[model samples]
Target: MIAQIGDRLVLEGTHLGDARRIGIVVAVAHADGTPPYEVRWLDTGRTSLIFPGAEARIENRHPDETSEPAR
Candidate 1:
């Protein structure tokens, strides 16, 4: 999936009782907003480069948005 910087990447849990992971897209590897994003995770305050899998989804950020949903 495509994503922009500041967009949130959500990786749904792979198994029962597992928690989803959320991260902000800090950098994009391609000019066309393609995959291989550099993300800073919310939980542990760590950054990683990721090629998102099937369970991942993007929550785009809009300029007019006031705030993000509760984590």
Candidate 2:
């Protein structure tokens, strides 16, 4: 994974439940986009969360810094 900040996270849960959430990438721990992500989660009712590696989506951000999608 080589994503940047302010990007969306698309992850797959390996547990037993079926759920999904869309959040913004507030912080990036590693440059590889592997772990340690601070995201304002959307599943737990607009709360901030830190995902390890399996809970994330995409990193959709424009380099121009024009406008990002508030998803």
Candidate 3:
């Protein structure tokens, strides 16, 4: 997945009734926008490196604007 610094990452739960986790891409470790991204969680003000799974998806930084979703 390719992302910009302000993009949002949503990790869908693996099982039923599991809550979704959302985070913003704080840093792009690579110039090519590859993972292990430095993301700051929206639910909690915590940051970590994330290598996304199959359940992961991305929300564009400005949802009201005409930007594309990164995946």
lDDT of each: 0.92, 0.63, 0.83
Q: How high is the lDDT of residue 32 in model 3?
A: 90
Q: How accurate is candidate 2 locally (lDDT)?
A: 0.63
Regions of model 3 farther than 4 Å from truth: 63-71
* Alpha-carbon deviation at 37 in model 2, angstroms: 0.6
Clash pairs detected, candidate 2: 7-59, 8-58, 8-59, 9-56, 9-57, 9-58, 10-56, 10-57, 10-58, 11-56
lDDT of 3: 0.83
| Candidate number with the higher lDDT (1 or 3) | 1
Report the Cα lDDT for residue 3, model 2: 55
How well does candidate 2 match the true structure in TM-score terms?
0.54
Cα RMSD, each candidate: 2.0, 3.5, 5.0
Q: Which one wins on TM-score? A: 1
Clashing pairs in model 1, backbone N/Cα/C closer than 3 A: none
Per-residue lDDT value at 1 in model 3: 84
Candidates, ranked, TM-score: 1, 3, 2
lDDT of 1 by residue, 1-71 (tens): 88988899999999999999999899999999999999989898899999999999999999776655565
The ten-residue window of minimal lDDT in model 2 covers 43-52
Mind giving the per-residue lDDT tens digits that candidate 2 earns over 1-71? 55567776666666789566666677778878765677766555363556546455575677777654543
Instruction: Say which prediction, candidate 1 or candidate 2, comes out ahead on TM-score.
Output: 1
Q: Model 1 TM-score?
A: 0.88
Best by lDDT: 1
